[model samples]
Target: MRAAAGKYRQRNSHAIWRAHAESASHPMSEISVSATSTVDERPAKFSASDGTALTGTWFEPSPPRIATTVVVIVCGAGIPARFYHHFARYLCECGAAVLTFDYRGIGVSRQGNLRKLKSGMEDWAVLDIPAAFAEARARYPRLPLGAVAHSVGTLLLGAAPDASRIKRLIFFGPHTGYWRDYGARWRWLLYGVWHVSMPAVTKVVGYFPGKRFRLGEDLPRQVALDWAGRRRPELGRNVEEARRFRLILSRYREIRAKTLVLSITDDAFAPPAAARRVLSLYPHLVVTHETIAPATLGCGRLGHLGFLRRPASEFFWRRAAAWLITPNVGDEPKTTTQAAQSPNR
Candidate 1:
């Protein structure tokens, strides 16, 4: 799908990333404790299959012992790993190790200029996502793997070499990129932003300056183009030279994880219609499709990017984490069954 909007009071958040990066290390790094004092955070680095360097962070239970589960946060199109920190820490507190990383040419993994970075959505799906899974498996062997994919992150999940290793998955605002599927009222406006103006602007700047437009971080030229050009309901391009794209979608069948596809009522970018199209691609998985109305959660509004943000997290984050640690997906967790109960305060 497209990059989500809504920064949730973000102000120089990248500086926080830089502050942590100053003391980054291999596998492990300097630790910082969350306000809850129930999670331990550390910086970690790894490389993609193509030897392109990537950066990530690990969130573990307060005492920092190895956990029985690892939930990798597959970020959306232009958003960085930091956007999902709230969700990651919640997973950690629930006794699951969480891994959140920036895709190539994004956030901490960004190198040089993005326009020169030749990677596109396909590169992220095949090279980067697999590498992330590999890194997680190598670091935490034999533990059950899970993922929380947001927006285009859902598309990236299929081509991962370790897709079968994922025992549970949560598709947050998952959608197949079909412009017609946008919510009725805001359809044209969003289409104008993502499909029309985005490409035009990216063409001039040599990248998608998403932050300038309040649409998450800037993206590589091809990443924006890929998002813009994929107007069809399908996963990838439909013409010739797309054999590789077809090959990537073919791997969708490999993912047999129990999944929960969350379609936010207020998420015009990813209505249930659009999210269902993504679900259609994964026929082999045991899946549950849930449409969450803001009123039902008493949050007033939870947009495409709001699930992991405040207000919503205060009311819903823990319940979502509860699903990841459930025995239905993996082995027993160190935390109590209360972890799976309703997250309402």
Candidate 2:
């Protein structure tokens, strides 16, 4: 089953690569990492709703105190929980209990003999996210529960109407308008990919090969398809079905939790302009916006992914830490114009 899945992913990835190659805008290369930078702490494993074990690590601050709050880190599409290790560790050291986990059918989650079919989408947003929330709440009932979601994770979390369980939400690089950014041809192609090709491919192959089939990476095909299909509507037949599950503009109003939206000025995926529009949807909610400039961080172009790649990304991490440690103080609204003109930290 794994071999079959691998083969499928290679083919699908190649097709996507071809699509990218035909475009003028070159996708950013995957970031390289130094061996010494790896966080060696072993993650504690917990069982999800289906008894699938989810892996995560707990970072305890020096002289551990009674936990005041707990923060669950939700990663973006196609990236593993480990990708946020540095940020999680930093939060843990600063006295906030942190939990980061992989979605079912992705990362270390057990892949049953069940072939990757059209059904995995139900598991990701419904089972994985809520289960993680339940597990964290179960373990730390007294502490305030908060969520920090990146990219599509934000969309998934935002799609949930009853966000009352979480006291606060920090959305890092949330994807607001993906379809608008891509060309009409690509949008149609993505639609077909998500609604038709992916479900069909998963049903036949027992898994989507887009990323999960990779040697070291454990990204699920369902998540990749959901992400990819947003661009090329032609590839997906059930665009309406996909849109129904999407974080529509109306859904933003239902996010009751105190929220913080963070966007880097150079983020290629979620530009600051689009992010500001997203922020406007949640008028009643307390929102704080900050822009990270590449010059301040001493990096050439601190694009979307670079915020995590460089440890010296103190501009983002420091502000994030301050926000977490400090109370209601950081939850204020900022306009896109203000964010742009504000001096770099």
Candidate 3:
């Protein structure tokens, strides 16, 4: 596993993404996922519903045959989809095609101008995520579909179209992200960062340089502003705020797919309360919530982003794979909820 990851790091890192503009495609770029050559990872491109070209990496399952199911991975805020390469490859090895793409204004998906990017979480949901699902459905019409999201990715999923096509919805560190959702120890810090510092800094620089703070990539001004002002359902103030809110609420209510919401006990950004708040949005779904302790996985910590790292893949990735490949939700006992935790509480 270490050798495979090393090869991915040396060959297909995000630095390679810098070579091509978002509108350009790397037609034949390929990377062998492991020393045994079990999976083939290739750079691919697709367009969002708005005619915006997005960039992604497609991990093909072994045997080079058509896949019966495809897993689309949507990343957290600031973090690019390339960060989930190993996880995607793992899913591919488990007999599923996986496509991990950057949301607009992020990594390889950031086209022509960086400073003038007008995308936000709503664009990802209504445009990017839905486009990915459409692309996958178009490419493999009869295949079962699955989506795995992290952090804000889950909220984006709640707003995306074609929820009926997705058989399973897997959420990692899902949260509504209101300041009140945070624990006492981190509430003030989150409030200051999201509500105060981010807006103030973005206002001066015209963008938030998240890379400097090791948060992820630098984000567009509007993206940061939207995140900062995400405290209320009214969206505080904006022309499209009401419409975006309605779209998200409507999408969540429309979903009937089975869901698995995973939360790390030690995750400061998405504790049980925070994750459950987002789970509450899908009132008509069969949502199975699991809170895992780091020690149980033999890891020192499993924070909001830790589960995606290679070392912890065995703990969560297998379960994700089973959820994706299963014929039905009941085929796996893990899909059943023993005592369903209500988000209302």
Using Cα atoms with residue i matched to residue i, what is each candidate's TM-score against the true structure?
A: 0.83, 0.68, 0.83
In angstroms, give how far residue 12 of model 1 lies from its true place: 37
In candidate 1, stretches whose alpha carbon ends up further than 4 angstroms from where it belongs are: 1-36, 329-345
lDDT by residue (1-345, candidate 3, tens digit) is 000100000011111111111112532222223567677788878998779999998888667555768888989989888788877877887778888899888999887666788777778878998888887777777777888989978877878878656877788888765666666687789899888999998888878989887778888888888788866533335666665575557677677667777787788888886775666566666566667776666567667775765345555776787777766743344432333333332
Q: Encode model 2's per-residue lDDT on 72-169: one tens digit a residue.
A: 88877657787787777767655677888877666655466435434344456566777777767877888888888886677566544445577777
Candidate numbers sorted by lDDT from highest down: 1, 3, 2
The residue-by-residue lDDT of candidate 1 on 1-345, one tens digit each, is: 222111111111111111112211321221223545777799979998789999999988765455779889999998899878767877777779999999999999999977888788878988888888888888888888988899978877887877878888888888656688788889899899989999999999999988887889999998888888867655546666366666766677677777766778889888776775666666576665567777665556668875765445543455567778867543323232111111111
Cα lDDT of all candidates, in order? Answer: 0.73, 0.56, 0.71
Q: Quick one: best lDDT, which candidate?
A: 1
The superposed Cα distance between candidate 2 and the true structure at residue 105, in angstroms, equals 2.0
Poorly placed runs, candidate 3 (over 4 Å): 1-35, 64-66, 233-240, 328-345
User: Regarding lDDT, does 1 or 3 come out ahead?
Assistant: 1
lDDT, residue 200, candidate 1: 98
